[model samples]
Target chain A: MKPFPAVLKEKKRYVIFEIISEKRVKEDAVKKAFFREIKSFIGINGMADAAPTVVYFDEKSKKGVLKVDNRALKQVEQALSLIREISFNKCFVHIIKTTGTVKKAKELVKRGD
Target chain B: MKAFIDFVASEDCVSFGKKLGFSRLLFNELSRDKISKTKINIISPKSPEESKRQLRNKMIDIILDPFDKRGLFIDSAFLNIAKQKQISIGISFSKFLRADENSRIRLLHNMRRLTALVSKLKGDLVLMSLAAEIYEMRSPEQLILFGEMLGLSRAQATWCITESPKGIIRRKSL
Candidate 1:
């Protein structure tokens, strides 16, 4: 078996988003809430296909970066939007930008902040 | 670029929405008297007949929550009228925000049905936050994603938030 080349690999997208709430949130909690909502809304098969991951998160500023298959971008965004509460604090997730590479997404996050 | 607008219930929402990057603000109520202070006015019709009449009035920018009342608020007949008159229909995500478990299911069902109708008829569908406070408002990207979950395509959902309102403003200027 041979590994797929970089160009032949599945396309991925990085989403830069911010959490606005009365209190700050933790990275672990965000991951938990995001997956829970995604599972509930799109079911198990969709969740598996989504393959979402949290690449960057700043607890102090409440900003983070998420990675997922390009095809599941909408599902990931919807899951993030459905997250009303994180660890008992009411909150809202605002997606800032999406890019094909994490470098661009991180740059956008820095510029946004 | 895209202009984001939210139909809010109070004055505080104006500043809140502005902070969140909304360019225009709409005041939503059941009153016929226009709010001179605000640029955009959204009327929440009390009845299906009222909804139809509002949709035809060029002065009134949008008909909010046509499905809020009992029975079919936006039937095929009303949609035809709306499309011809170039009036936009608005749906508030705030309802889904506060709905209970039982009511949430019902709300989803109604919203899915509404989105389907709008898509089929090729009618103007506007997405509004209707946020009373700051936290209730969602970003433009989130709204588009929410629209997709309800059955609209990515491009269609984006149009609901951007072009639909722009068209309303363009019509007002004309």
Candidate 2:
């Protein structure tokens, strides 16, 4: 099958963020919490439109990257802010920055450390 | 750059607020004497009746979250009085952030109603973290995003964090 043209593909934004909590959280928990919160706020169809996926997460640093559809960037941000708890622990997911490229998002996460 | 201020529940979150890029944080604590030491005087009235009474006082810099209680806490008439008195209505983000799924829906409904009323009346409004702990504190942009979700325009949301709070500080001469 021929690959879709670049212009026809959905543009993505990489969000760089870190979890501020008392203890380190497992990557799986973070992923679960994010999906649940986003789905709850934007609903299942909106989640499909946003297409959020956990791209990277460092347990030690608690920094990570999320790739999402560009149009739903603000919706993703609202979802991130609404996330009050993860794995029964009170926490906040602080966004560092959002960029068009995953490489830039990773660089920001490193620089934020 | 715009300067932002947050009305918090304790002194401990001040450092965290600073880290989150807030220029200043005013404490809205249980002990009035503790917060009296500061130049800015803010009042978090318990009931809608108290909010009306406190709005008449020139000594009060802000009225924090009268909508937290269950009832018709604010209306066009209340906003008219607030506007005439140059008092700003404080909307705490944590109240919405911390509510359970059932109550969150109700809270959001009430908040959207308040926002619409404020816009219609052209009343002064401010948004704050009012975080009890560090974890509850959110960045200025996040809070503004919340304001937008509650039916404020982007500019109005920005003003809620910036100019509206600044107006309160300026009125108090702080």
Candidate 3:
């Protein structure tokens, strides 16, 4: 198959979220919970299509940006919202903003911190 | 602009919520003595009868978790009474947070049913974080998203998080 043109590429969204917990959260645990929650919410097929990825995470600030297909935005948001515990500590994921570009999402995270 | 309110279990959470951008805070326990000192008070009834009694009293600002135990506590008849008395019904997101997988699904289904009922009756519905700690608090947008997932429209969800709580605060002051 020919390489798809840039215009034909799948549209993506970046979600900026912060983890507020009693203990600092590690990136690996965030990734684990992220996939687990998304899988549980939408199942394996949906996970394959959603193709969510943790593009950026700062353990010190406990802020991160996730890249997901535009079609899966709601599913990803719902999954993130439903996450109550991470690494045995009660936590809350507060989604700050969603943008089409990574730059804008990163800016929002910086301003939030 | 919108004002956010959370019904908290502990007195210590009041100030913590204030720091987290909550304009107003309500304590969930029903001690008349403590009510006077707090920003707001929520009357958590033990049974349907107690809920009915509290709804009639103008002093009682909110009916928190009326249907948490089991079965339908707020039926159409009770909703009409609440509407006539200008009383608001509250649903706590904390319950959903603490529920396990099976229970979470059931809770969501119940919430959707209750939200539909409240909308049909034109009764006031408030969505509270009911956070006991700072970490448990949710942003306004997150609350609205949660509301939407439970079958409420975006505008309705926004109202639950903003206008409904404001109305409760207004009535409390008046």
**Model 2, A32-101: lDDT tens per residue?**
9999999989999999999999998989899999999999999899989999889999899998888899
Residue lDDT tens for model 1, A79-104: 67767788999888888888889988
| Segments in model 2 whose C-alpha atoms lie over 4 Å from true places | A111-113, B30-39, B68-71
TM-score of each: 0.80, 0.91, 0.86
**Model number with the top DockQ:** 2
In candidate 2 the C-alpha lDDT for residue B38 amounts to 41
Candidate 2 local lDDT, B1-174, one digit each (tens):
889888888789998899998998887764445445346666767777777777777666667666764754777887887888887877888888888877888788878888888888998888988899999999998998899899998999999999998887877677
State in Å the error of residue B122, model 1. Answer: 3.7
For candidate 3, write residues A1-113 as lDDT tens digits: 99999989999999998888889889999999998888988889999889999999989889999999999898789888888888888888888778999998888777765
Fnat for every candidate? 0.80, 0.76, 0.72
DockQ score of the complex predicted as candidate 1? 0.59
lDDT of 1 by residue, B1-174 (tens): 677765677677787787777788765664688633335567777787788777767666677767752444889888888788777777888877767545766777878898899889989999877877777888776787778877888899888888887787676662
Question: What are the chain B TM-scores of all models?
Answer: 0.83, 0.88, 0.82
- Colliding residue pairs in candidate 2: none
Every model's DockQ: 0.59, 0.82, 0.72
